[model samples]
Target: MIRPDHPASFLEEGPFRTEEDQYFWKALVELTAMEETNQGNLAAFVGVSQGYVSKILAGKQVPKARLRRRFAEFFELAYEDMVALGRQHLESMGYPAEGLPGRRCQVREPAYGGAEAAGRPAAGQGEYSALRSMVRDLRAREAREGTYTEIPLREATASMGGGSTETGDRTLSYLSFRTEWIRSKGNPEYMTAIRAFGDSMEPTIADGSVVLIDEGRRQFVKNKVYYLRYNGQMYIKRLVDAGGRLGIASDSDNNLLLVSDADDFEIIGRCIWTARELD
Candidate 1:
């Protein structure tokens, strides 16, 4: 850690009462020393001028509110530390410390990989293991409960193209509707809600609408709306068999899309249902 060579009393002054100011000064000095570079190098790293760095270090200039947060983030200082340091500096200079950010701690639930390996040793697995564990636990819990938790059958059914299935030995067919609900039991497949942003699929699926997609469904069907992954972004389009090769088309227009290689594109999921808000 690069300690400021100046006395702490020097920082006690006007405009440094906020915690953000303390974090900014500390982060700036630390970052400058960590790189073993002068004000010029520090300025370039933070997208500022060398004079700006010097002015800040000398307490001759006060950074704006926006840049204070950015500086704290760049230096990886804790929120409380940033605020506390600012208060100390401001108080020393006879300035009133106002609206300092309170200390906050965040707790995150641990993720699991599978049932058989529940809470087992898995290093470097991170989110992957946690997801697997959650799925396994959910399935086991649902099976023990012995009930099909009701989901939005309308939305779910619409997304899956309204296929009816007989539940076990029951004579009556249980109707499922596609909705935005998921069962709390079973080995349920992962689904994601994505907001449409472009006018590529206008009219049928307008921009700013939300679509529910099942990531597990990679199979393509002719003339059905599906989420297609190409390049790095995902697009929703209808897949059609043009002659002997696969061709994609937009629903708003009848124009056929140009295809170079089928391997480059991947079918992410069939569009189950879309939710749009009226203006």
Candidate 2:
């Protein structure tokens, strides 16, 4: 671990109080060092002079907010993830939890392939990862802050029968939709795309159907289908009022499962649209 060798602090006085300020900067500097490389490469990655990288490593400088985003890219992490990590580190170092990140964010370990696994140094994984993140963030940011609207096509499948265990939640890609069209359904921010498995909802929602879900619509609406989790299993089924109880049903088979208060049920979203491959 590269210890802070210089006396300069990384942040200006503001959000953090005096007592907590020291640990905040200390945590950030140490976290940044975990991704540090040779001086020249580090400077190039951050688009800064070698001297700036040196000063930063020595804890004598703080990157601006935009540059922090670059650091996030370099570290192959979201900016919010970095902040959450720094908060966790600070708490571990005996700093108070108040005024830090309100929620915990999990930092996933990066998977390395052949070369690194064979005891060789990484071949520009940092640069490549940073570039990918930059492009992905740019596209998502454009959709969020500009006129465009893009819904994420998640890499997941919801079963129509017994229930499918969700494999992953990564965004495989995005599906562009008209801003006006999305608004007519629900909030654009809550929209996502996932595939449905099994023929249980066939004739209504077929097997291999790409379903558009509005995750914000968690309220129970009678006769509406939903992507939900029941007892730790994922499903796409119509929700109905079962006389003060909740009912889950498959369309094609007309199978119904009533939920009691003791059952664990969570509504992920309301299905608003669907598409299936012709073949």
Candidate 3:
């Protein structure tokens, strides 16, 4: 039995005893969410019923050796990681790690350009031109230093519920900030303005507030509010680093949301300032 003071012992009292176990489960959820695929598709790919996949995601049922390999293949992850996890589980019980599945082929890289491989539009294609124009416009405006700096207002909204998909290629408009005021924080070119929705981050960040994000500051600062994306979901919250495990917390919610390695987590920028209507 693990001690109560152990930090990484999340769900220690549950069916998940080891980090590898939780990683396997989270990897499934994160990959499925990233791919925008449902459990039904995963079931079809893994030769299992949708109910079984649900059980796996819920940590109610552990996948067998064959099913584990199938999951690795479907997610394009290394099967050896799953095999190593199983070996660790067996070895923890004072049992031999022998007779488990061996290593398989490595994951192959996409044979295309970086942007296309990432499913994003390449240069001069799709909405790429619009995005480039926005960048150029921002650069040109920043070059003409004056009393105020022009900050591009993003067309999308950052919701506290972790779901905001209205990302536009071009900026809706620009909000002028005092040149001295904006310069104190960082370069004006790296600053952006975006509307924030949801009340989970109330008091500190009211609903419908226009939040200023310092895109140049991507470094992780504990307890600071940030605009981030995890598992393909956007969020505006304070990040708490509990040892190695990242915890996403909200001003309105007391519970901390644990972020695992499998989560496609990226800190878009740190929230520096906010302007909201007086209610």
Candidate 4:
């Protein structure tokens, strides 16, 4: 049986021991003192009450064994430093040093089919499914209202070479920010931003126009514009539910795209607002 009085004795009996035990302990103490200058910081790092740090520093109480490794990691001290410190403290008190507490490892059972075989759904699949449903409901509501929200615009003038009234004025423009325009009402999750692409949305969303997207809605509405993703690429398009089948369409044209594989598309957010520059 190993003596618990000396911490170093535990190392001799165990498979692991540090050669520079004394130096390691001194380094650990110095590091702890340097970083943990106040009781509050020390308590937070050690996950203990502030009173505990004061008690330990004042030599009124010995730190619990649970704190040893935590202190080592928080202070960035080496394993050898922790062992050396424990050994020194035991020797000074004329007590036996016991080995470190054993750590438990958790083992999980293998999934029914291995991780690869489980076939996890691609990212954003759940969100897209939810958005598609919501769009369907929103379209019904919009039909009752009989009118659509108008997008706002901004204007800017382009400078021509050399000031001359004879030359026609050139202008560049875009959408104005609608911070105060969106009432949001009681729905906190509703948000709006300019949509800036047309790869999947074409006529519905011009490349330069801003789009407003809502983070709250999770249902899909057939034949409504939505921000979507296929593979890793992002797209905005109108999604239509052809019975159980999914079809994608661009706002610019009437052609429809079939989406058989769920991995091919993802809904990033719903288009709630759009801004275009007036010519």
Global lDDT scores for all candidate models: 0.50, 0.68, 0.68, 0.46
Candidates 1 and 2, the one with greater TM-score = 2
lDDT of 2 by residue, 22-138 (tens): 333433454443333455665688799978866554545566777767766665556665565555555654533343321111112222223355353553556345433543564
Q: Mind giving the per-residue lDDT tens digits that candidate 4 earns over 1-279?
A: 233444444245432244343323333333444332455666798899977665444333445446755656665443444565444533543442343321111111112233333254332345234323433444454443333333222131111111111112122333333334444522323443432633335555665566666646546877666656555455556788877888766666666768767565666556666656666
Stretches off by above 4 angstroms in model 4 are: 1-181, 184-195, 199-203, 262-264
**Best-to-worst lDDT order:** 3, 2, 1, 4
For model 4, state the Cα shift of residue 21 in Å: 56
| Candidate 1: tens digits of C-alpha lDDT, residues 179-213 | 22444212134555555555656777777666656
Name the regions of candidate 3 deviating beyond 4 angstroms. Answer: 1-145
TM-score of each: 0.34, 0.48, 0.47, 0.33
Between candidates 3 and 4, the one scoring higher on lDDT is: 3
lDDT of 4 at 162: 14
Q: Model 4 TM-score?
A: 0.33
Model 1, 252: alpha-carbon shift in Å? 0.9
What order do candidates take by TM-score, descending? Answer: 2, 3, 1, 4
| RMSD to the hidden true structure, all candidates | 20.3, 13.6, 24.7, 23.7
Worst 10 contiguous positions by lDDT, candidate 2: 102-111
